[model samples]
Target: MSKDAFAAAALALTAAAENGSNMCLSFLNALPVTHAAISTLGAPFGSETICASDSQAARLEELQIDFGAGPCWDALRTRAPVVDADLSEPTESAWSLLREAIRDTGILSLYSFPLAIGELNVGALDLYATTRAALNLPLIARASALADLAATPVARQVIRRLPHLDTDDTNPATYSRREVHQATGMIIAQMRVNADDAQALLRAHAFTLGRPVREVAADVVARRIKFTRDDVVDRD
Candidate 1:
């Protein structure tokens, strides 16, 4: 990173700290990426979009949710950076569906950097490029540094919002999808399971119904869907 780029990144991150992760997407403009997104790993919802540079960036992030496989997913799952500078190349065999989706969108490169603090994996920073070219070592280092700087703020926001969600008289849409967290706690109470398994069950039920996790969480919160020991039964 050059001196000017480094200064700009610092200023952008300062702005993000003041507002939220929504302000962080603009930070990627200093890089070669055309579009970008920040996704946080949620308990019941798998990965939820935190912010994006634009609608196109948001849609690129959603490809993982729609198709269930992508570089972002891999990075979060394995706690490693997924660097694919050329999606059109035949070298990628892990996520064929995601590659085709990117190709269809006219994006030629994709990158994912996991946000981890020690053993805890929080989320991922995803980037897209319009041209087909590999990223050099310096560029990769800059990307990694930016991802590291942004991760803590994102993680802190999630933690700060948890208490608010657990209390009474809180809005559901205050911090993105708050119902998802409430529904996760409800599932924990109903099933007497750990957060991980409860969230997995929640996601499985959503997948079975072919609906988004937030929509299913709304049903759960409304007392419309109940999870029994052996089945997810509808109360309606």
Candidate 2:
């Protein structure tokens, strides 16, 4: 892509960001990618997709959520970008379901960029291509920048829905516990651990019980689940 194209794409993404849409779409759409999707990763809520350019992108996003593992998950967990220039080349392994589905669709390339806010990991922007090809350095750099710009709007949405996360509200009963951020914070206070560790514990229990993290978090807020220095207590 030319410098002029890059500049125009960036401007489009900025407009999308201000309106709280898929801010990185224009930038990646300018590339060879066939489809793209942005998803927010969180406890209880799991992977909430923000936007997708088309149906293909939407299906892949749903696949990532159902499988609970993919390049998006890897990027979010590592706080870095993940590039799979060819999904068919890798015969087998982790995220097998996602790999197989991608193979079936004949989309051979995948890229994921993490939308990070300092030490906090908010989400990822995923790209899919019908052919096997790597993104050029300039495109990758621009996409990364777009991912960074995207974080602010995504974070704002999270905060707006879960106001208790920003405030020092102690009463859990006052607000809705349908989201996991509040429960995650409650765990942090109870265990005196960092946000990441608190989220890990919450996910651990949810995975163990084959339940959604948000449901598990609601239990925590309702005093059905308690966290201590040693372990987590379950009233149910």
For model 1, the stretches where C-alpha displacement exceeds 4 angstroms are 42-46, 164-236
Residue 125 error for model 1, in Å?
Answer: 0.4
The residue-by-residue lDDT of candidate 2 on 115-143, one tens digit each, is 75544456888988888865866777777
lDDT of 1 by residue, 27-137 (tens): 566777788888876543346787889999899888876677788778878867788888777764777877887879999988888875443456888888898764566
**Given candidate 1, what's the lDDT at residue 49?**
82
Residue 20 in candidate 1 has what lDDT? Answer: 59
- TM-score, prediction 2: 0.65
C-alpha local distance difference test of each model = 0.71, 0.72
Candidate 2 ranges with C-alpha deviation above 4 Å: 21-24, 163-236
User: lDDT of model 1 at residue 135?
Assistant: 56
